[model samples]
Target chain A: MATSTALSTTEAQRRRARRLTGEVLASWLFLLPAGLLLLAFVFYPLFYLLYVSLLHWNLIGRARFVGLANYSSLLQSVYFWQAVWNTVWMTAGTLVITLPLAFFTAQFVHLELNRRLSGLYRSAAFAPYVFPLVASGVVWNLMLQKQGIANWALSLLHLAGPHWLSQGVWPLVSIILVTTWQFFGYYTVIFLSGLQGVPPTLYEAAAIDGASAWTRLTRITLPMISPTLFFATVILVLQGFQTFTQAYVMTSGGPNGATTTLVYYLYQEAFQFFNIGRAGAVSVMLLILLVAITLVQFWLSRRWVNYDQL
Target chain B: MVNSIEPLRHVLSVPPHFLPLHPEVGPYAGAWNSAPFGLFYLNTLFMASAIVLGQLVTSTLAAYALTWLRIPGRQAVFFLILIGLMVPEQLTVVPVFLEMRTLGWINSYQGLIVPFLGSAFGIFLLRQSFLQIPLPLIEAAKVDGASRLQILTRVILPNSKSALITLAILNFIWHYNDFFWPLIITNTNHYRTLAVGLSMFFQSGSGLTPWNQLMAADVFIAVPLFLLFFLGQRYLVQGVMTSGIK
Candidate 1:
């Protein structure tokens, strides 16, 4: 009995050691390709961008070390500040317009509409979301043209339509409006799913207790969908910072840079003018801005987003 | 004729659908003046097909290896893929362009197809789906003396159809809509995709980009994607619901 027990114990130790080795080996094999790709493409490029940011490098010329000059120049450049302001304004405009439209649409679909109509409305709202960013830009630019359908409709109503493409603020407004139209459906769908997750019993109880629709929304629905709201906002903000396609297609940061966003500026510097070093600096700045915003989001999420409420 | 076709009549006479429709084809309701519509449609179909096929094959292989095989350093590999998710494709634009140029693949299908084949997001999403496949099924396969490839093909893949479809649809839509990579890589009109071709047409300084023509082009590019999504929307939503927060 003692010999058998000792033999079994030894076997158990061997099995444990073999399993550990297997796990370690398995993990390495699974991870190799993904790790190598990220390391080459992500980490390498990021550090290279940082390194280039400190230099006075154009595409053709040798990169010369110019520490802090690019950073200082960028900080001082009024164009940089204007682009930053434009990006912030555009992001804010999209959020303000999209959030309310999505909220009410979610409510309409979830609370009021029948399944069939809800499906129709849901698809209608979401139709714009699937359009390629460039395609949406093209379509909206057409719709917003000086003598386009929008103006034609306005003329029929005897109201003067603004020159959407050529004008200063109107182009910005047009871009924001188009972006919202394309994106609002995604958020609405997200919000509807959030609403579905909210237990119907709570809403029923609220209704019985003399809570108005507004009261129920503020007290319950809003809190319940806060997590979804958080996710949508992060995505929106990230896209906003990375706004390039629309600007590239529609305005090209036109009408004297009225809509020149930071990413557009980066594109101009990097690709158009071939100012590689400066572009790298700008990319680094953009990354920093994104990181800062993400930190703020994390902080706010902790305070308001209710993950455990469900 | 549309009125005689009841289902067609309701769709054609609607507010959104009140736009234009070309006979025997999809919506081309707007003016067809600026450029021929044929170019954009063919280009978009070609690009979307290439991207979807490449992404599906590459990502599935990567996911399969990661999930089923007792491969070495699996966790580390998975983490690397996750990191790829965060690296903006913008960063690699220059190098990729250079690589394409060196390979003489610039302005060709090869340029568009090769670099975008391995998507970290696709790998990650499919791996999540693969992980949920029960271990008992694989054990049962083992009892029958099934090889690894047989288990993957016969058992795991057959059960993971929803996940596969979801990935395909997402990939198709994303590739169909992507502009930047296409714009950077392809220069000539012959080589352009829908997004790139449309932008080039608009920006060609060709008589102020005739509004009706542009919107018509937009309709052309968007309608097929919209149809696909509308058809598969339930599955798309289900996929999102199933996939955990990244």
Candidate 2:
């Protein structure tokens, strides 16, 4: 009997081992496509980018080792500094317009407006986002002309509209306005969703205590939806850093490179000038800045981005 | 409104007329015939379909494996995906562009489609959805002598329809309107998608603006998306939430 039991146990263990091996094989087969693609397109390219950043590769002749020369040059380059300035301010500009408007609009519409009206509002609001950036930029390019509708409307209000595409500050502002129009609806929806997640009983309790609307919003709503607020802010900042299309389509990084954001500069350097080494340097810096920004965001979020409730 | 008016207007009138009293289809037809927008439409359709299909397949298989199977180095795969999620395309655009050039994929469909075939966002979205599927159903399938592929197709996928649709719609819209990568990879009118095509058309003139035709083209480009957005707003919004910390 003992011998028979031992034989059965060994057979069962062998079957289990075989099944485990098959499972692992299946898992690997499933993982292979995504794994290979991500590695090839994402991970390997990152290392490749770093290596290229270290060389003076111009897509002509042989690449020579340049070490940190591109980075140092970018530090002193006027165009590079202007590009950085444009990126920071444009992002800040968009955030300034978008955050308050989105938050307030979400609260007002989500709380007070009926569903029918809110749907209409959503359609109008998200239309800009739905419109292709290039196409709209093209349209806005026309609309912002000297005698175009944008200026005409300003004339209606007896206010002067600046030369939107040609002027230095106004070019950036025009980009910001278009971006705000594009993104406000999307962020409002996010804030709306976040607002909805806040428990109604908290509001009821505050109401029972005769809490005013302002007090209720400050004391209850703000703290509860802090996570969503933080998420939106992070996205806004990231989106700012990557603002290329507007500049490309609207300004062509032009009017004396007034609107040349970092990405625009990188594109010109890499493709137009074929300065692959310099572009690679810009890319590496962007990646590092992105990581540093993300880290800083997370570190700062612990201060006020509440996660306790949910 | 002015798109119709511009067709009727004899001059570039300021504060352009809102109503098209003597409207004609000349501008629309002229715009359509002037450029290869038909080909642009086809290229966009082809690229979006290829990318959406490829991303769906890769995201599903990877999500299923990571969720259902006890694979080694699961943490590493997750970490890889997280990095993929965080890194923007521009950060890697230089090297990837070089890679594409080396592969002779510049101005080719391969350049447009291959890089986006595996989306970290899609995989993450699907994984989150898959995690919510009741384990007993999968166990029951296994007990019924179903193969792993059958279980995935018949059992797992069927339950994740909404997530799948959300991803598809989002992917389709995004790639359909994507300009940056397409602009870089495709230089000629032959491979240019609609967004790139329109931008090129706008720049075709040497600062001699074609307002009527441009508006007509812009309207045509925008209307289909407006329809899609109205139809899929719920899915798009849900998809956005998924990308957030939710």
Candidate 3:
């Protein structure tokens, strides 16, 4: 009887081992398509960008192996520095307008307003987000036509309308203003979510301690939602670097290159100049710039982004 | 992972390229001024309708399949869609444009509409929402020999209204703000949408842009969506709270 039992147990163990192997095979089969697509599209393009950067690749000529010449030339170019400056200034300009305005509007809208009115306010604020870039650009163009409603409105108010799309200063403003109209609601939505995470207990305690709305906001609400802010800022920085469509569609790199952001410059080099090698080199720089900016933001976020437990 | 593109307010603050000759008279002075307003409203309405309609059909079917269909390679398909979440739209420009050109659909609504049929983020969001539906209810329907299609339409969808709406709003904002795809595909003014139209206006170089006119036009595009959001604020808040955090 003991010998028979031992033989049965060994047979059961063998069956279990075979089942485990079958499960492993099934899991991998299920995962294969995702892995293959990632390798082909995501990793291939990334590596190809590097390979193209090393060659004197243009549309018309053979791609001769030029080693790191493209990178070196990009580093020395004045346009590279100008793009960097534009990216930083645009990011700062956007943050200044968007962050505070979103926060204030979110604070007010999330307060004890009537339900119907609150809905109107939220939808109205979020309206710019719905029109495609093409539509927004067209609408703004028509409105900003020399004797457009905007100037007419200003004319009524006895103030001269600035040529916002023409000169350097207002072109930058044009890009910034359009961008803010699109994003403020998104940030507001994100901020509202972060605010909900903050318990009412904290607000009640602050109120009991005679804290003003401004004080409670600065001391309590801001700290709690720091993580969300950090995430938003990271996205904003990445976006600021990739600011192409507006420059492409609205300004076309400028009223004298005032809005020629790095990505747009990359697009022109590759498509217009047929300088594929230079474009690859520019993409490489952009990748590096973005990674560096993200790292810095992550490091600074530790100081202010308050993940609490993290 | 669905995200919105930035709008162009900065351009709106600029003046018109060439001011129209002012009729030194009454309300007709302002009536013509509102042409930009009419243009803004028209563009916004068109974009919003297309986006909401596209998202409703695509997300519903994709979500249903991922949730209920007991097909071979189902998990594989879901994961494949999920991989699209991280790929920036810019990367797809060359291939999509090539595809559109081949189809002879360039500068048409079909070119704009067809490619977006597969929305990975929408599928994922709706799938998550479907996952929240209690299993026992579905099982009870199955026991009654209900068709899989009937179960999805009757049981799963009704329970997931809030999630569906949230995904719709998200898709609305995203497709509305899209510029690169529309710009590359469409060539003429007749096909030009708002973002593309604005770009042409800015680059036309006929003259300086009038800031107030731009701002007024900017107001027109922005106001409608803002009003809708206010109406849906609670649901929007609830949508974000559940979708991302949970």
Report every candidate's CA lDDT: 0.75, 0.87, 0.66
lDDT of 2: 0.87
Q: What TM-score do all the candidates reach, one by one?
A: 0.85, 0.97, 0.69
Candidate 1, A1-310: lDDT as tens digits: 9999999999999998897677556545544554454455456667767777888877576779999788899999998888899899999899888988898889889988989898778777777777788877876775676756677778778898999987859989988988888788877877788888899999889989999988998889888888888887887887787777878888999888888898888878877888766777788888889878978998989988888784
Per-residue CA lDDT of model 2 for A15-131, tens digit only, reads: 999998999899999999998999889989999999999888779789999999999998899999998888989999999899999999999988899999986786676667767
- Candidate 2 i-RMS: 2.0
Quality class of the docking in candidate 2, CAPRI style: medium
DockQ of 1: 0.31
lDDT score at residue B213, model 2, on the 0-100 scale: 85
Candidate 2: which stretches are off by over 4 Å?
B8-12
Docking quality category of candidate 3 according to DockQ thresholds? incorrect
- RMSD of candidates 1 onward, in order: 5.1, 1.6, 8.1
lDDT of 2 by residue, B72-105 (tens): 8887888789778977888899999999999999
Q: Please compute DockQ, using alpha carbons, for every candidate against the native two-chain complex.
A: 0.31, 0.67, 0.17
DockQ of 3: 0.17
lDDT per residue for candidate 3 within B171-193, as digits (tens), equals 66556556666666677655655
